[model samples]
Target: MNSEQRMKSEVEIWKRKMMKKSGMMNRITKKAQDKINGLIPEKAHKVITESIKKMVQATLFGSEYLTKPKETYNLSLEEKEALIKDSLNKFRKTAVVEGAGTGAGGLLLGLADFPLLLSIKMKFLFEVASIHGYDVKAYEERLFILYVFQLAFSSEEHKKNVLETISHWDEVKGELVDVDWQVLQQEYRDYIDFVKMLQLVPGIGAIVGAYANYNLLDQLGETAINAYRIRAFNRNEITEEIPLDSDK
Candidate 1:
């Protein structure tokens, strides 16, 4: 197979893997997360929800960390993937280090990890958007980033819904209303509750934090890349398969 064919195959494999039905473990975890959600105080939940909403809004509209969108139309799939892979690696390392530092600092610092890690994730997404040639300054494009974020951290059922929405974004973007921040915040909290809670523990928090953050970034990176691949494929930018060794 040629390079383009290989790339298409890789993307197909990723899509199938992402769409696969959740297994028994996933269901059990969902149930556990639901119960934990019930135990969290309403006040605490409200605070977190509002905090995340503001933080995300600021990041989406802010120019501080945004990069100039690349003109990848002239770049080959292989070249684009190389840039993406590099960005993902850099973000993964940053997340690991942030997780380790917060995890080692005890409860207060571990608590601090929520916003810190969030910023890292959002900034990484912005970079990914630019690399994929998506103009982040556009309102729809910023909304798309939220959908991608939701896809990465939401439950399996939510993931399926988000994937469908994003897959046909052009059709749905017009009628879309404001994002349901409440639902978004709740789902995110539940999804990470178990792992993050462990990161608050006194003894093993550091190790767990670093490990969890590393894997989280990896998962987000995969989702971002495949999500953009769907768009590229739809636009016919990645339709033709060339020889693996072809310079063109």
Candidate 2:
């Protein structure tokens, strides 16, 4: 198979993984996360959800200034992805540097990494959309970016649902008018809570922060690439069949 065909095969594998059932470790994690969440006050949850909602909205609407001019419309999938790889590398470095700097500052600066890393992730997604020949300026495309974010960090069950939406994005895009901000914030926070907590440590914070941010960007890069790949296939009427079994 050629490069594009190979990429399609890889996307197939990713789709199956996305739809696969949560493993033992995942269940354990979810159980712990749920218990911890239950201990937190409802008011605190509301505040956090609202804060995340506002932060995301501000970033989404204000990110146009951060986007580069699109020049990938004429490029093939392989070529566009080559550009995306370059973009991913650039963002990964930025995330790592920011993570280390903030982590070194202990609790105060470690807290700052949340918004900083979030902006970096969203900005990278915007650029990826551009690379895939999509208009990030459009409302639906921006919403799609949020779904991509959710898919990367949500629980197994939620991830499957988001994957289904993404795989058939064109058909379902009209129905998705707004995001479930509470779910978004909760899932994202729970997903990274442990590592981020470690990033507040006095001595090891720098190393943990740098490592966590690098891996997070790596995960985001994979998700963004395949999410757009699924869209590409959908547009061409070549979408793959994702397994629906709930068992690993």
Runs of candidate 1 with Cα error greater than 4 angstroms are: 31-47, 237-248
Residue lDDT tens for model 2, 1-248: 98767987787677677667778987787677677666655654564466578766864665542465487778888888889999999999999999999999987787778778887888898889877877777778888989999999887779988988887898898988888877899888888776676787799999999999999999999999898887887787874664555352
lDDT (C-alpha) at residue 175 in model 2 = 86
Error of 2 at 71 (Å): 1.7
lDDT of the candidates, in the order given: 0.79, 0.81
Please tell me which predicted candidate would have the highest TM-score against the true structure: 2
**Shift of residue 18 alpha carbon in model 2, Å:** 2.6
- For model 2 the local lDDT of residue 136 reads 75
TM-score of each: 0.86, 0.87
Clashes of each: 2, 0
Clashes of 1: 2
